[model samples]
Target: MNARFTRFALVAGTVAVTTLGPSVQAQALPACASNAICLWRFQDGTGELYTWRGGYVDLPSRFTDHVGSFRANRTGAFVDWASGKECHSVRKGDYASNYSGRFGSKIDAVGDNC
Candidate 1:
Protein backbone atom coordinates (compact mmCIF):
# COMPACT_ATOMS: atom_id res chain seq x y z
CA MET A 1 0.00 0.00 0.00
CA ASN A 2 2.87 2.42 0.78
CA ALA A 3 4.51 1.67 -2.55
CA ARG A 4 1.24 2.32 -4.36
CA PHE A 5 0.83 5.67 -2.58
CA THR A 6 4.34 6.72 -3.55
CA ARG A 7 3.67 5.92 -7.18
CA PHE A 8 0.46 7.94 -7.09
CA ALA A 9 2.21 10.92 -5.53
CA LEU A 10 4.91 10.86 -8.16
CA VAL A 11 2.39 10.71 -10.96
CA ALA A 12 0.45 13.63 -9.51
CA GLY A 13 3.59 15.71 -9.20
CA THR A 14 4.51 15.01 -12.79
CA VAL A 15 1.06 15.94 -13.99
CA ALA A 16 1.15 19.24 -12.10
CA VAL A 17 4.52 20.16 -13.51
CA THR A 18 3.45 19.30 -17.03
CA THR A 19 0.30 21.35 -16.73
CA LEU A 20 2.15 24.40 -15.42
CA GLY A 21 5.27 24.32 -17.58
CA PRO A 22 4.00 26.06 -20.71
CA SER A 23 2.52 29.04 -18.92
CA VAL A 24 5.69 29.60 -16.96
CA GLN A 25 7.73 29.56 -20.13
CA ALA A 26 5.38 31.82 -22.09
CA GLN A 27 5.88 35.03 -20.14
CA ALA A 28 7.73 37.02 -22.78
CA LEU A 29 5.96 40.37 -22.46
CA PRO A 30 6.92 42.76 -19.75
CA ALA A 31 4.34 43.84 -17.20
CA CYS A 32 2.45 47.06 -17.99
CA ALA A 33 0.15 48.51 -15.41
CA SER A 34 -3.54 48.91 -16.14
CA ASN A 35 -4.60 52.02 -18.12
CA ALA A 36 -1.08 52.62 -19.35
CA ILE A 37 1.06 52.09 -22.38
CA CYS A 38 4.38 50.29 -22.25
CA LEU A 39 7.19 50.65 -24.74
CA TRP A 40 10.17 48.39 -25.03
CA ARG A 41 13.53 49.08 -26.57
CA PHE A 42 13.69 45.72 -28.31
CA GLN A 43 11.39 43.34 -30.11
CA ASP A 44 9.11 40.93 -28.27
CA GLY A 45 8.77 43.36 -25.38
CA THR A 46 12.33 42.93 -24.21
CA GLY A 47 14.88 45.54 -23.11
CA GLU A 48 14.30 48.93 -21.51
CA LEU A 49 10.74 49.86 -20.54
CA TYR A 50 8.83 53.13 -20.69
CA THR A 51 5.28 53.46 -19.43
CA TRP A 52 2.71 56.23 -19.93
CA ARG A 53 -0.75 56.66 -18.47
CA GLY A 54 -2.08 59.63 -20.43
CA GLY A 55 -1.43 63.06 -21.90
CA TYR A 56 1.09 64.20 -24.47
CA VAL A 57 4.47 62.88 -23.49
CA ASP A 58 7.64 63.35 -25.45
CA LEU A 59 9.84 60.33 -25.44
CA PRO A 60 12.97 60.73 -23.37
CA SER A 61 16.20 61.13 -25.30
CA ARG A 62 17.03 57.48 -24.92
CA PHE A 63 13.64 56.19 -26.06
CA THR A 64 12.68 58.84 -28.61
CA ASP A 65 13.73 57.08 -31.76
CA HIS A 66 14.56 53.70 -30.26
CA VAL A 67 11.14 52.26 -29.38
CA GLY A 68 10.99 48.81 -30.90
CA SER A 69 7.73 47.47 -29.48
CA PHE A 70 4.64 48.71 -27.62
CA ARG A 71 1.61 47.59 -25.65
CA ALA A 72 -1.31 49.99 -25.24
CA ASN A 73 -3.55 49.15 -22.32
CA ARG A 74 -5.62 52.33 -22.37
CA THR A 75 -8.52 53.50 -24.47
CA GLY A 76 -6.38 54.85 -27.28
CA ALA A 77 -3.26 56.83 -28.18
CA PHE A 78 -1.29 58.27 -31.05
CA VAL A 79 2.39 57.88 -31.73
CA ASP A 80 3.98 60.89 -33.34
CA TRP A 81 7.07 61.33 -35.40
CA ALA A 82 8.87 64.19 -37.18
CA SER A 83 7.71 66.68 -34.62
CA GLY A 84 4.12 65.42 -34.83
CA LYS A 85 3.77 65.52 -38.62
CA GLU A 86 3.42 61.76 -38.75
CA CYS A 87 1.23 59.73 -36.40
CA HIS A 88 0.03 56.23 -35.71
CA SER A 89 -2.93 55.23 -33.60
CA VAL A 90 -3.10 52.37 -31.14
CA ARG A 91 -6.27 51.27 -29.41
CA LYS A 92 -6.84 49.63 -26.08
CA GLY A 93 -5.35 46.17 -25.80
CA ASP A 94 -3.29 46.69 -28.93
CA TYR A 95 0.29 45.57 -28.98
CA ALA A 96 3.16 45.30 -31.37
CA SER A 97 5.92 42.85 -30.66
CA ASN A 98 8.09 44.40 -33.35
CA TYR A 99 7.39 47.70 -35.07
CA SER A 100 10.85 49.04 -35.66
CA GLY A 101 10.52 48.73 -39.40
CA ARG A 102 7.03 50.26 -39.63
CA PHE A 103 7.75 53.24 -37.37
CA GLY A 104 11.45 53.22 -38.20
CA SER A 105 13.22 54.79 -35.23
CA LYS A 106 11.12 57.94 -35.55
CA ILE A 107 8.71 57.86 -32.65
CA ASP A 108 8.77 61.29 -31.02
CA ALA A 109 5.76 61.42 -28.72
CA VAL A 110 2.65 59.64 -27.50
CA GLY A 111 -0.78 61.09 -26.75
CA ASP A 112 -4.47 60.87 -27.49
CA ASN A 113 -5.40 60.90 -31.17
CA CYS A 114 -3.26 62.05 -34.11
Candidate 2:
Protein backbone atom coordinates (compact mmCIF):
# COMPACT_ATOMS: atom_id res chain seq x y z
CA MET A 1 0.00 0.00 0.00
CA ASN A 2 2.80 2.46 0.83
CA ALA A 3 4.62 1.85 -2.48
CA ARG A 4 1.40 2.21 -4.43
CA PHE A 5 0.59 5.53 -2.77
CA THR A 6 4.12 6.83 -3.43
CA ARG A 7 3.89 5.95 -7.08
CA PHE A 8 0.52 7.67 -7.43
CA ALA A 9 1.79 10.82 -5.76
CA LEU A 10 4.84 10.95 -8.05
CA VAL A 11 2.70 10.55 -11.18
CA ALA A 12 0.30 13.24 -10.05
CA GLY A 13 3.12 15.62 -9.29
CA THR A 14 4.61 15.08 -12.71
CA VAL A 15 1.29 15.67 -14.41
CA ALA A 16 0.68 18.86 -12.48
CA VAL A 17 4.14 20.22 -13.29
CA THR A 18 3.76 19.48 -16.97
CA THR A 19 0.32 21.02 -17.17
CA LEU A 20 1.37 24.22 -15.40
CA GLY A 21 4.68 24.69 -17.19
CA PRO A 22 3.33 26.39 -20.30
CA SER A 23 1.12 28.80 -18.41
CA VAL A 24 4.09 29.95 -16.36
CA GLN A 25 6.04 30.91 -19.49
CA ALA A 26 3.15 32.40 -21.46
CA GLN A 27 3.76 35.83 -22.93
CA ALA A 28 1.35 38.76 -22.98
CA LEU A 29 1.15 41.81 -25.18
CA PRO A 30 2.40 45.01 -23.67
CA ALA A 31 0.02 47.88 -23.02
CA CYS A 32 -0.44 50.38 -25.86
CA ALA A 33 -2.42 53.58 -25.63
CA SER A 34 -5.56 54.31 -27.64
CA ASN A 35 -5.35 56.25 -30.93
CA ALA A 36 -1.67 55.48 -31.12
CA ILE A 37 0.87 53.25 -32.81
CA CYS A 38 3.35 51.33 -30.67
CA LEU A 39 6.53 49.68 -31.85
CA TRP A 40 8.75 47.13 -30.15
CA ARG A 41 12.24 45.93 -30.94
CA PHE A 42 11.52 42.37 -29.90
CA GLN A 43 8.65 39.98 -30.58
CA ASP A 44 5.61 39.74 -28.29
CA GLY A 45 5.83 43.46 -27.55
CA THR A 46 9.02 43.05 -25.53
CA GLY A 47 12.27 45.04 -25.54
CA GLU A 48 12.55 48.70 -26.54
CA LEU A 49 9.22 50.48 -27.18
CA TYR A 50 8.32 53.53 -29.25
CA THR A 51 4.91 55.18 -29.39
CA TRP A 52 3.59 57.64 -31.95
CA ARG A 53 0.32 59.55 -31.83
CA GLY A 54 0.76 62.36 -34.31
CA GLY A 55 0.48 62.66 -38.06
CA TYR A 56 3.03 61.35 -40.57
CA VAL A 57 6.39 60.81 -38.92
CA ASP A 58 9.61 59.08 -39.81
CA LEU A 59 11.23 56.69 -37.41
CA PRO A 60 14.40 57.69 -35.68
CA SER A 61 17.75 56.24 -36.65
CA ARG A 62 17.69 53.55 -33.99
CA PHE A 63 14.23 52.28 -34.94
CA THR A 64 14.61 52.38 -38.73
CA ASP A 65 15.50 48.72 -39.14
CA HIS A 66 14.65 47.24 -35.77
CA VAL A 67 10.89 47.07 -35.49
CA GLY A 68 9.88 43.49 -34.64
CA SER A 69 6.35 43.95 -33.27
CA PHE A 70 3.63 46.56 -33.35
CA ARG A 71 0.17 47.51 -32.15
CA ALA A 72 -2.25 50.00 -33.69
CA ASN A 73 -4.67 50.94 -31.00
CA ARG A 74 -7.89 52.54 -32.15
CA THR A 75 -6.12 53.85 -35.25
CA GLY A 76 -5.16 52.70 -38.70
CA ALA A 77 -1.67 53.28 -40.02
CA PHE A 78 0.86 52.46 -42.69
CA VAL A 79 4.30 50.97 -42.12
CA ASP A 80 6.97 51.96 -44.59
CA TRP A 81 10.28 50.39 -45.46
CA ALA A 82 13.66 52.03 -45.70
CA SER A 83 13.32 52.24 -49.50
CA GLY A 84 10.31 54.52 -49.02
CA LYS A 85 7.84 51.82 -49.98
CA GLU A 86 4.73 51.02 -48.02
CA CYS A 87 5.17 47.70 -46.24
CA HIS A 88 1.66 47.10 -44.92
CA SER A 89 -1.40 48.52 -43.27
CA VAL A 90 -2.44 47.97 -39.68
CA ARG A 91 -6.07 48.52 -38.79
CA LYS A 92 -7.45 49.80 -35.54
CA GLY A 93 -6.86 47.42 -32.62
CA ASP A 94 -4.55 45.32 -34.76
CA TYR A 95 -1.32 43.94 -33.42
CA ALA A 96 1.52 41.58 -34.26
CA SER A 97 3.71 39.74 -31.83
CA ASN A 98 6.30 38.83 -34.40
CA TYR A 99 6.41 40.49 -37.85
CA SER A 100 10.10 40.01 -38.64
CA GLY A 101 9.36 36.93 -40.71
CA ARG A 102 6.93 38.68 -43.09
CA PHE A 103 8.10 42.29 -42.86
CA GLY A 104 11.80 41.77 -42.25
CA SER A 105 13.84 44.51 -40.53
CA LYS A 106 13.54 47.35 -43.02
CA ILE A 107 10.89 49.45 -41.35
CA ASP A 108 11.70 53.15 -41.76
CA ALA A 109 8.53 55.12 -41.24
CA VAL A 110 4.97 55.08 -39.97
CA GLY A 111 1.93 57.25 -40.68
CA ASP A 112 -1.84 57.43 -40.64
CA ASN A 113 -2.05 56.19 -44.23
CA CYS A 114 0.08 55.07 -47.11
TM-score of each: 0.68, 0.70
Candidate 2 lDDT over 13-94, as tens digits, reads: 9999898776634366788987888989888898889998867788887877788788888564556655657656677878
Give the clash total for candidate 1. 0
Candidate 1: list runs displaced more than 4 Å. 1-27
lDDT of 1: 0.80
Task: Judging by TM-score against the true structure, name the best candidate.
Answer: 2
Local distance difference test values of all predictions, in order = 0.80, 0.77
Compose the digit string of candidate 1's lDDT tens values, residues 1-114.
999999999999999989877662433577689989999888889888999888898888888878888888885555665664888778888887786776727888888777
Which lDDT value does model 1 have at 62? 84
> Cα deviation in Å at residue 50, candidate 1?
0.4
TM-score of 2: 0.70
- Name the 10 consecutive residues with the lowest summed lDDT in model 1: 22-31
